[model samples]
Target: MDKKTHFDFVTSIGLMILSLVMIVDSYRMGVDVGGALYASPGMLPMVLALLLLLTSAMLLKRSIRNGGARQNLAGFVAWFDIFRKSRMAREMMVGALILALYTFVLAPRLPFWMSTSMFMILLMAILKATSLVKNLMITALVVGSIYGVFQMVFHVPLP
Candidate 1:
């Protein structure tokens, strides 16, 4: 298949996997609360995961119908080569890596606001989207807003 179709196929598979994981985790969170299914803490997450799974399945079917299933080893290799050589693809990969690092590494170790600020600053710096001072100001505003919303409005503790 073409690049777009190949990309869609890959993305669908990833989404399916992610949705499955979410489904499992949400299920483990307990699907029923006080005899009420909708009252469960996991209800919304489970519903969202199911929706994502359904959409991913549809995408997968469409990709396969559009010749994605005909892609062979050589074609896959060629696609990877093209992806590796593209500047946009490289930037996207870097951005994804940074997000993963922030989620899995930094968030677990640091306070919520501090980790979020660091993530925003690092991401903007790596993307060269703005000057350091501007990035810091933007990060501060965004994180402060998040903190205020969670702590004051929602009465929720951030971690």
Candidate 2:
């Protein structure tokens, strides 16, 4: 087992625990006596919790069948060794940081379209999306489509 598989197992367990907590919290939120199906405050949480539970279960099963214990037995040093010179690991870390920056820093400060377009372009570049023209086209199309759906169709205000 390598870092990817080990990380998958760890993430599965963590998400399973998170979903269990969410389920409990949702139950505590209570069902409304006068509400229609899924009209209660707990409805969304319950749905998300179940989806997380189902997906994490599948991930755990797959990870266990794919030498999960070997990674566990390797210890932190061995795990660290796996990514000592890995460009992909560094890229992934940077990608995650970029995503965090987009969500927390850019999304709130900038207008929705500009922030989203910048995020899409940056992410595409990081992932090595085709030529420059193609990247811009994809980013514009995605931003336009999202803007159309939310602003025109849904008539929702964006940050």
Candidate 3:
């Protein structure tokens, strides 16, 4: 089997197993605020577990259909190549840092529109969007849509 497909299969299986473990651990934490007829702390874990299970199944099926051979050390070497590329690795790291920044700095106190617009604009700049006007317009549209969904429909409190 091809290297990428082999890694995909292994990663999917690993994630599924991890999710199952999380489900069990969360279940052991018991329900939230009640013993029965109420959502538990287990709810999120169960949802994650189901998603992981489905994703893993799909990956496994794809690998099988592609006639992937057994993975080996060479497959791991191929996986390591993802880290060898400086540009890709930097992008991945920067994206993760941006997410952390949003969670900690923006989510707490900034107004929904302000913080979202800022984040979206920054994302567009990072992606090297061609046109300034187009980027601004697209960001406006996206922020507006999210604002409508959160404020108008769900009526959720926004920071």
User: What does each candidate score in C-alpha RMSD?
Assistant: 7.7, 7.4, 7.2
Write one digit per residue (lDDT tens) for candidate 3, span 87-125: 978877777777777779987778878888887787777
- Report backbone clashes per prediction: 0, 0, 1
Where does candidate 2 stray beyond 4 Å? 1-74
lDDT score, candidate 1, position 101: 89
The TM-scores of all predictions, comma-separated, are 0.58, 0.54, 0.50
The lowest-lDDT stretch of 10 consecutive residues in candidate 2 is 68-77
Give the alpha-carbon lDDT of every model: 0.86, 0.83, 0.75
Candidate topping TM-score: 1
lDDT of 1 at 75: 64
Q: After superposition, how far is residue 11 of candidate 1 from its true place, in Å?
A: 9.4
